[model samples]
Target: MTDMRAAFYDSYGDVDVLQVGELPDPRVGPGEALVEVRAAAVNPVDWKVMAGGLDPLMEVRFPAIPGWDVAGVVRAVGPDIPEVEVGDHVLAYGRKDWVQAGTFAELVSVPVRAIAHKPAELSWEEATALPLAGQTAARTLRDRLAVTDGDVVLVHNASGGVGRMGVQLARILGARTVIGTASERHHDRLRELGATPVVYGEGLADRVREIAPGGVDVVADFVGGVYDVSQAVLTEGGRYASIAEHDVPGIEDRIVWVRPDGAQLQWLADLVADDRLEVDVVRVFEELEDAGAALRANREGHGGKVVLRVSED
Candidate 1:
């Protein structure tokens, strides 16, 4: 096995637990492809998993690598991996059932079912940014909320990565008018994305009601603490879903932990290739070693995705 540098955490804690050093290369399992990672996007789950916040829900092995979103070239294929060949550019929501090795590394072993061809029109960073957030957004809108044609959809926390895509995807999926919540600073940008922008916080429901009048037909909550707002503004029998796991009184909304699907990714990639979809890569860390910083930035909640460029050096 070759030696490769990776960002891993030996124990659960703060960013200080992260280590950037050499480790034995991962073994590609049957039905998997070994990818040479060019970029990996960091999500809130990376930091949460690293700090043991999800200990009750997941198993974490020591010296665990700390990312899941990867955009790379297939370096090799394990036995029985007929889906991808060496040298194919791909992206994956390379989440294993358990936490052990991950994508914040020079290479990753991705299941064939989790890999999709990267859209040629997108940069590596942009492609990396899409897997986790984009999938979550797409699934939340399509499956969980059951959004459909002419539905008045409201996207909460709509300035963040998933929320931004949720707004766009809702439109593409035939939402009549998309309402989104963000800070005053992001209102114009939301408007440009074809969403009716409203400031989040107090009286949010009122603002949404003014725009939709008859209440929203669907609510995609990327942020917690908005169940009350959604309830107030959603029409009777309206659907609701949240990417976050927050406790909200009286509303039984779907709490989505999105699963990896290469087919879904391929469809989304087609949209990106057609220029109807865009990924906002707000920040890119040039070194994989700074994965800790990237995780911290995810918690800070920027306008778009945070990514790490895995340096070949």
Candidate 2:
């Protein structure tokens, strides 16, 4: 076995349990491609899985290498796969159940369908940050809620990763009004992104109503407890899409599940290439060994996505 440096959690525990050690380098199977990881982004899922919160949803194989978003160059293509060849720059969503090769390693093997061309304009860090949050935002607005140019969309947590992308996607879709909820600190930045920023707090609903008195046509709620506020401002026939758990009246059937879709990712990549979409990488860690620290920092609610620099520069 050719050894590779990987971050692994041998048991369900705190961030202290995560360790950097030698492990077998991943090999591409049929319909898969081996990636020489350049960068990987840490998401909330990484911490949740490490803390054993998602054990029921996804079986935790002990000694799990937990990371989902990766950007790298193809090292090898498995037999029967011709869509990509060795040395192609790519970004991938390593959905644990579907493709378990974690990105917290120097190399990983992902299914062909899970990978997309990395945009030339974006760095490996920026590319790595886009897959999970970017695809979720695009799907929630374009496919699930059917948001259009005339729709008034309210994006909860607009300064966060998914929320930022949602704000931009709403603008691209020609939305008439894009209202976002964030703290006062992020208000100016949201305004720069073409959205009206409302402070998220006790009077969230009233503030949204004041901004869009016509009523919100669609609400994208990434904040867990915003469903009630969303329902209050949503107009008749409006839709509410949430990435977090919400049990609000009249929005029970509007939950958006984040599923990996390569075509949609490819579309976003094209947008990046054309300079239509932008990605923000707030910070990048220098090595996979720092993944645990990154996860802890993200869990503490530091702004933006945290990325790990996996390959030597």
Candidate 3:
């Protein structure tokens, strides 16, 4: 059996528990493709799951390799798979049915349903960063909220990885105005992305109201704990969706859990190819040994996507 170098942890803990070592090559199952990982994205959920934060919701096995977003070349294909071929550049939100083998490694087996062609315009780091955050924002604003022309959209935590993507996607979806809640340091960056940046905290609703006197037509809450403020500023019959909040009363599907959708990812990649979307990756940590630092960088709030480069493209 072949082996691959990867970052894995035997038990759930902090970043310190992660170890760079060798593991068996991932098996290519039917309808899947074997990717030689070039880069993998670092998200908050990687460390959160490492810390056992998802204990009740997801089944996590011991010696779990952490990372869900990947950009790489297809090395081989499983039986009956035709969506991708060997040597094809691809990216995927590679979350499987369970938590075990993952993308922070030399190779990962990804279901074709989660795989999309990586556009030449994107670097490995950019492609790696796009799948999860981009898909989350698209699912919330485009798919769920149905943001459209002349809509006034408000994005909470607009400076965050998902929030930044949300801001850009709202513009792509034809929103006339976007008000983003972010720290003062990220205000200018948010403005550059076509959002009116408002500092979060006290008077956040007032600031949003000042931007849109009538009310916001849609609210995308990337950061949790701002439901009251969102409710205060939303117009009557306005739509709302949250990735981090789930306690809203009377809303059955308000919380959006992003799924692996290749078609959705392909659309985002095409947008990147055409310069309609930006994959804002602020930092890239090279090699398997730097996985801990990569996770720490993501946890420290870098205001953009973080990537771990596993191999040269």
Lowest lDDT block of 10, candidate 3: 244-253
Q: Which of 1 and 2 is the better model by lDDT?
A: 1
Best by lDDT: 3
Q: How high a TM-score does candidate 2 get?
A: 0.96
The residue pairs found clashing in candidate 2 are none
Clashing pairs in 3: none
Candidate 1 to truth, TM: 0.96
Candidate 3 per-residue lDDT over residues 1-313, each given as its tens digit = 7999999999989999999999999889899999999999999999999999999999998789999999999999999987999999999999988898899999999999999999999999999999999999999999999999999999999999999999999999999999999989999999999999999998898888888999999999999989999999999999999998867776657999999999999999999999999989999898888999999999999699999999995
**Clashing pairs in model 1?**
none
lDDT by residue (1-313, candidate 2, tens digit) is 6988899988888889899998888877898889899999998878888888887777777668878888999989899988899989999886846324588998898888888998788888888999998988998998988888798999999989889889989999989999999888888888888899998989889999998998999998887887778889999989888878555566557777777677888888888778888787778889877888888877877557889898964
Give me the runs in candidate 3 sitting further than 4 Å from their true place.
Answer: none
Candidate 1 structure quality by residue, lDDT tens digits, 1-313: 7799999988999988888999899898888999999999988889889889989989888889989999999999999988899999999999988998899999889999999998789889888999998999989998777788999999998898898999999999999999999998888988988899999988888888889899999999898877777889989998888877467654554788889999999888888989898888899998976788888888888688999999552
The candidate with the higher lDDT, 1 or 3, is 3
Clashes of each: 0, 0, 0
* Candidate closest to the true structure, highest TM-score: 3
**TM-scores vs. true structure, each candidate:** 0.96, 0.96, 0.99
C-alpha local distance difference test of each model: 0.89, 0.85, 0.95
